[model samples]
Target: MEDGMGFWNLRNFNLAMLAKQGWRMIQGNDSLLYKCFKGRYFPRSSFLDAKESLGCSYVWRSLLAALPILRSGYCWRVGNGSSISVLGDKWIPNHPTNKVLHPINELADEMAVSELIDSKLHVWRSGTIMSLFHKEDADAITKIPLSRRVVPDSIS
Candidate 1:
């Protein structure tokens, strides 16, 4: 394997001599080594695209354009540009069942996750009980006058 200086000089020479003159050169073995160092996500497919995109002429232009975006850390995010539905913690399926019957909280180590799980279960039970008595639910209870409210220790 070439040292960093060796790779740097190679890229320097390739970019300066070939690319600057509108000629393209995609060094296959070198690029494999380069990507291995860089943690490229889609290596094989990206390699194929790079091969075609950087074919024997004018391909360096795209690299020039791509450099800034790469430097700025502007890669696509997971939920980006898609019509996927967003769901929150309240949509947890077992919430209603767990609320009706308290479960072992020791299954979770983190206080936030465990406490939130317990709270959801309690909320579910409260709503169920309220419904049985034809009474307004906790969401309705939330809108009651602040002066008459009793807040939890965590909230205060």
Candidate 2:
């Protein structure tokens, strides 16, 4: 029992040290575990997309197990809205669902919220809003406060 407690304490201390340095201590470009955790949500084309790759280290497998929990807590914060997909991103607030209902017109897959804003006026383009969003959705979108200066979108 005493040996187990000592091991547990040492493990926690190591984790705390890693946390303190923002996990920068574990830096190795070739490390499978590092690759898995660093871009778990958006993996590079060369990296393995599978949750459990064959012959993966125990650490890599453990990171895969934690991916779902990490993803569940992530939420989008609309800023300039350039990065978010108009129909695909979950930027809308206070709706039954965060995504916009079926867009009236078939917008490009990469269409962004910023495209709906009038560049000169720095406000939502009424015509575009009316065309893209349902009445209720348009009304809900209008309530979101737009900053005078454009900023980059963020994930929280």
Which digits, one per residue and each the tens of the lDDT, describe model 2 over residues 53-143?
Answer: 5676665555445444434434456777776778866677776667786666677877888898776666878787877778988987877
Top candidate (TM-score) = 2
Clashing pairs in 2: none
Please tell me which predicted candidate would have the highest lDDT against the true structure.
2
Q: Where is model 2 more than 4 Å wrong at Cα?
A: 1-61, 70-73
Candidate 2: how large is its RMSD? 7.3
lDDT per residue, candidate 1, 1-156, as tens digits? Answer: 357665556555554453322211122334543455224322453322343232333443444434432323222111111211112111112233212132233333221222221242222234333433223223332222222222221100
Candidate 2, residue 58: CA error in Å? 4.5
Q: Candidate 1: where is the Cα deviation over 4 Å? A: 1-43, 47-55, 60-65, 80-156
* Local error of candidate 1 at residue 27 (angstroms): 26
What number of clashing residue pairs does each candidate have, in the order they appear?
A: 1, 0
lDDT of each: 0.29, 0.61
- Measured against the true structure, the TM-scores of the candidates, in listed sequence, are 0.16, 0.59
